[model samples]
Target: MQARHFKETYSELLSLTDSVPERVWTGILIAGCLALPWVVGSYSLSFATLSLVMIVGVLGLNLLTGVCGLISLGHAGFMAVGAYGAGIAAADYGLSILPSMLIGGLIAAASSLLVGIPSLRLKGLYLAITTLAFTVISTHVILNTPEITRGSTGLFLPEPNFFGYELNTPQKYYLFCLATCVLFVLATLNIMRSRVGRAFIAIREQDIAAEMMGINLRRYKLLAFAISAFYTGVSGALFAYHIRYINVDTFGLTLSIEALGMIIVGGLGSIAGAIIGAIFMTLLPEAVRMFFELFATQLNGLFATRALELRGLIYGAIIILILRFQPEGLIKIWRECRRIWGNWPFRY
Candidate 1:
């Protein structure tokens, strides 16, 4: 009787995965998201919130590199635009947080248009170099625009709100961030599985061939940039609100590289890969930090400050190792595991 009951439960759970419609799956995901903060511990909820924000950045970069097949080393500049915009709108303009975020996203998207239009015309290395140049320009602009960004001093942001309630607690903030990230992810999945997604894949596979097939390169390419920039901007706005502070140092070239590292390790061109990348990269540092704290107690001195430098070296080396051994990344390995499990009986 117990064996029968266990089989029944397993079958029921597995059937949910097979029988659920796409729309129903979305609704279920939404329901789960709403329940997450309540069910999970506060610390875990906070970590999930940060992971979701990282997902936003990863999604944007994925669109640019994975979909559009355009590499950008200046994505962090787009993020900076959103971050500072949120800060200024929240503090000086005294705007609502929702509108502040929207404003930041639109402005970031618009700014990318200028960068994308011309940069898209260039091919390969030239295009990457152009984007990198934009990063340099963005740094200079932030440093010089003291009247607006306040230079290196940074600015504080107003508290986020919903229905006149300040989302002051980590739980509240986590809910908002998680909701937005999930929304973005769902929208991205829908878009990627649509006609535009096909065009993106076509272009990625071969731009000239895609153009031959009647896909408009300029329009789609710009669309990719605009879409990507929009997501990054939203994430940046969320970051600003969560931290409630902003400066030039917050967004830089290092962040851009980190984004690349995440997508590469998680799986380039896969949304699942992007999310996996974000979670791993964001949490890994925290884990490393904890190790350093424990190590400091044992090693007694000098190790605490030196630990950060060691962390950087470790991060770089690990990335290199992952690329060398598993260039297809974590996503490919995940898919393989699923495939193997599905065909387990054939193994005999």
Candidate 2:
């Protein structure tokens, strides 16, 4: 069957309407996700919840690096700000879950100004290095401020309360994360479809051309940073609650690199790419561990001793392979499959 578009007018052609298949697929996915916790065990549910949190953070990076062409290496620093901010609010201030998360996100957005303003003049590698420096400074500050963040000792978070109900169970937390992830996804989609999103894309393609076309580079770039930071901050807050523990060491440079890899391997500038990439990367380590466990007798404890190194090696290799063969990322493969299915039985 060959799918055909028979729009009679330009408006119809340009409308962002979902085809029947797309709508049906989306509905099925939603149903499956909603039913996942009941079918899966606690460990699997925990993994899915973590994946959702990463999706939020990765989506933020996609907006900045993918859509706006601004490379950042201090994303984890912003996450730290959010996590600490939310942790302080919930733990020390006695605020509920929702308010603490919002406060954390807002504080992260404000802190982004420190780098966003500098981004007005910086580009490419310079901007990335500048962000990296911010991350270093952020960790130092968090570690030094023993009174506030408890320094290297770490901060403990209480169970999140939603409308007086304590989200103590893994299933409840998973549902909360899913709902939050869906909201952020919708927000990102809306942003990408709006004038701001167009401006970001224009800047990404050519800043000078965008400037000539009357786009305010200063405003949009800063806005991008703020929005991206907010998303990441909320993600950090979720992470803090998910684990109920956090320290400066938690938001390390490696975590930032991992987030960057998620966007790159998922497909830059695509929402579906962010989601797919997060899930794939999140599951990769677990898959490796499973393989090691399956071959424990043959390996004779070698994997147990050098698990981290082996995992990193395999992860880097897979990323390199993906870059070599599918530079456009996994989303490209998905689209190709969908296209093939749509055009099945029509050789021409």
Candidate 3:
């Protein structure tokens, strides 16, 4: 009876919007997001738009690698598929940005099956290699297929429009990206509380145990890949629209690694972690560059060149420190802070 009561209490704690303070904070954040475009300049708005797109992409990856224990190093390739898919539709079919992006997501989802099926039999590092190979091959295909993907020359896309309104300016497009990010993040949170989410957690912890409990390993694993691909693909489509150009080189292996780093630094299997990581990783490099520009005179000119070269090394050091000290990521730190505040006036 005590165990049953404990389980119920624990479940209540896991409720998505249970706490009044949390709900209040969420509302405030939403209001701020809605008002941000009016106050921010174009460059900041553009940066925020890119951050939102990355947040969506990272959430999808968290579902796969974080929740389902699927290791993939080919995420950028999937994004490329999405970008090209939407670009082709918008260019060739005269479709609007909204519908074309959806089509791009669908195309990427379908393509994921090709990799998912073969790699299902493999686990861990082997599976990672399979996905890596897929990314490499996908890039080559994009580069060689000049007829379809425009090859090395790249494809230019018109500014995205919706309901007859053009979203050419960064401020206008910020709203579009913001809406999509909010919707997708909410969807991902709901999904993490559902039966499918439970199954994913099970698989991640112990696949054999999950199979014994009647979970279909094959189906769910592929589903993870497909859904992750869909999210990434949509981000790619948005990227194409945002950049107004598409090239095979844009979504490279480095981009895939960055996505992985987001999940790692944010927290595996955590939706909040994905968002936090995406924001941090996205802004960190830009902040560094800006700092260099601002301090170019105070620091030697040689420092600027070295800073650019050492960015990767600094990024690596940060990740290592996080993993070494707080492997659970920023979400854990955030939770700890919340817990401490909640326990104020009482020493545990």
Q: Pick the candidate with the highest lDDT.
A: 2
lDDT of 3 by residue, 254-315 (tens): 99999999999999999999999999999888877776777778876677568767666766
TM-score of model 3 (CA atoms): 0.94
In order of listing, the candidates' clash counts read 0, 0, 0
Q: Clashes in model 1: which pairs?
A: none
Q: Write the per-residue lDDT of candidate 1 for residues 1-348, one digit (tens) a residue.
A: 022233446556444233344458668877887888889888777777888888997898898897778988878888888888877888888887788888888888998887888886787889878877877787788889989988888888878886477888888888888878878887888778788989989999999999999999999999988898888888899988887888888887888889888998999899989988889888888777677777777875667567778877777787788889889888888878756765677743
Q: What local lDDT score does residue 149 receive in model 1, on the 0 to 100 scale?
A: 87
Candidate 2 per-residue lDDT, tens place, 1-348, comes to 424567777876555554778778888998999999999999999899999999999999999999999999988999999999999999898888899999999999999999999778999999999999989998999999999999999999998998688998999999999999999998898899899999999999999999999999999999999999999999999999999999988999999999999999999999999999999999988987787788888986788689789877987898999989999999999999887778777624
In model 3, what is the error at residue 52, expressed in angstroms?
A: 0.3
Alpha-carbon runs more than 4 Å astray in model 2: 1-16
Instruction: For model 2, state the Cα shift of residue 312 in Å.
Output: 2.1
Which of candidates 2 and 3 is the stronger one according to lDDT?
Answer: 2
Please report the TM-score between candidate 1 and the true structure: 0.87
lDDT of candidates 1 onward, in order: 0.83, 0.92, 0.89
Using TM-score as the measure, name the better of candidate 1 and candidate 3: 3
Ranking by lDDT: 2, 3, 1
Which model scores highest in TM-score?
A: 2
- Which runs in model 3 stand beyond 4 Å of their true positions? 1-15
TM-scores of the candidates are 0.87, 0.95, 0.94
